[model samples]
Target: MVHTHAGFAVAGRPTRTRRSAVALAVALLAVAALLVLSGCSSKPDVVPSADAASVDVAATVTVKDMTFTPATVTVKPGQAVTWIFDDGVVEHDVVAADGSFVSELMTQGSYTHVFTEAGTVNYSCSPHPRMVGVVVVE
Candidate 1:
């Protein structure tokens, strides 16, 4: 027996209750991990439309030096915002906060998303959380 500071006696070996608690904790952890991974997908929440090219892009943000050149842009409804990943050998992607858009991870490619609503959408690079940008649709 192990004596506690409060003069209570504790068992020297693990009890059945302690073993059950450990098993429960491990089971909960596995469930939590599965739930988190289930939310991930190869397809983005918002897909880039091929028609996006038909309309001219209102804003062109250059992904270089690990930052969006403009950092912010304003555009009218239905206008598109294009992100050009041209940092050369450095892979980057643009992701919207509201799940409105998501770009493919690329080193030298462009991604465009049209804003059909009037609101501000904040976004950032997945790999570089420090780099952020915003788009205000009017």
Candidate 2:
């Protein structure tokens, strides 16, 4: 027994209620983790067209040295464009000029965009406006 400031006897051990609460909390955490893990996928799902023998070209851009590589890229109207972030230190993002698309802040990974219309799409990094790129959907 431990004496409290008010001179009351306090058991210095876990009570039955406390033990049950701890066990319940742990069980809830485990269930939440299982739910999250169940939704994890191993790879990106890519659907291939059955009519076309060749797959549509997917454009890729590289972000390095605070600049968008190639700066300008042309792709077919149904093609997908992916941006790969090569810089690991500074953060960057891609936002279209006409509010078409926007990417989350990226450090070192990739983001993709598909051009469905035949037009020129200009994009720039929101944090660094000087770094710009263009996508010409033809």
Candidates in order have lDDT scores of 0.84, 0.77
Q: What is the lDDT of residue 56 in candidate 1?
A: 63
Q: What is the C-alpha RMSD of each candidate to the true structure, in Å?
A: 5.6, 9.8
- For 49-94, candidate 1 gives per-residue lDDT tens digits of 4355687689999999999989999999988988888998888888
TM-score (C-alpha, index-matched) for candidate 2:
0.59
Clashing pairs in 1: none
Q: How far is candidate 2 from the true structure (C-alpha RMSD, Å)?
A: 9.8
The C-alpha stretches of model 1 lying farther than 4 A from their native spots are 1-46, 49-52
Best by TM-score: 1
Query: Could you tell me how far off, in angstroms, the CA of residue 74 lies in candidate 2 after the best superposition?
Result: 0.3
Cα lDDT, model 2, residue 129: 81
Best by lDDT: 1
- Candidate 2 off by > 4 Å: 1-57
Q: Alpha carbon lDDT of residue 10, candidate 1?
A: 64
